[model samples]
Target: MSEAAKELNDIKRLMMLLLLKLGASPDEIALALQVDASLIRKTIPSRKVKKIVSEKG
Candidate 1:
């Protein structure tokens, strides 16, 4: 990826984590970002997803 593209991707990934931290589900995050849930799942590490989901409730 180009540096700019990588940076944008990083920002998107960070936003995903932030949304999750705020108790948004992956599906919700995807919807808010206009992306697919599979992309959200692919972007975030599984362990982090597990941690956030567990802590969300």
Candidate 2:
């Protein structure tokens, strides 16, 4: 990918992490970003998800 696209994707991932920390559901995040929820689930690290789930739970 081009540098700009890579940067944008990195920014998206960071936003995804922040949203997860804020307790936004995967589906909600996908909807907000106009992408599929499964894409988010697949892209995000399980460690991050576990951390958020543990913190929220």
Candidate 3:
């Protein structure tokens, strides 16, 4: 991927984690990010997701 494309991809994943941290559900996150929920699930493990949520909570 191009540099910008790679960064955008990284940022999207980060946004997913951030949204999850803010108490957004996977469904909500998928809708907000315009991605499939399955895509969201594939991008990051549930364990890390929970850790981010817990850290922010």
C-alpha RMSD for every candidate: 3.2, 3.0, 3.3
Clashing residue pairs in candidate 3 are none
Best-to-worst ranking by TM-score: 2, 3, 1
Tens digits of lDDT, candidate 2, 1-57:
899999999998988888887677789988988999899889885355634445533
Ranking by lDDT: 2, 1, 3
Runs with alpha carbons beyond 4 Å of true place in candidate 3: 51-57
Q: Write the per-residue lDDT of candidate 1 for residues 1-57, one digit (tens) a residue.
A: 899999998898888887777667788888887989888887875456534445533
Q: What is the TM-score of each candidate against the true structure?
A: 0.69, 0.75, 0.71
State the lDDT at 53 in candidate 3: 42
Tell me the whole-model lDDT of each prediction, alpha carbons only.
Answer: 0.76, 0.80, 0.74
Q: What is the lDDT of residue 49 in candidate 2?
A: 60
Better of 2 and 3 by lDDT: 2
Task: Please give the distance, in angstroms, between residue 22's alpha carbon in candidate 3 and its true position after superposition.
Answer: 1.2
Model 1 clash pairs?
A: none
> Lowest summed-lDDT stretch of 10 residues in model 1?
48-57
The parts of candidate 2 lying over 4 Å away from their true place are 45-47, 50-57
After TM-score superposition, what is the CA distance of residue 20 in candidate 1 from its true location, in Å?
A: 0.5
Off by over 4 Å in 1: 45-57
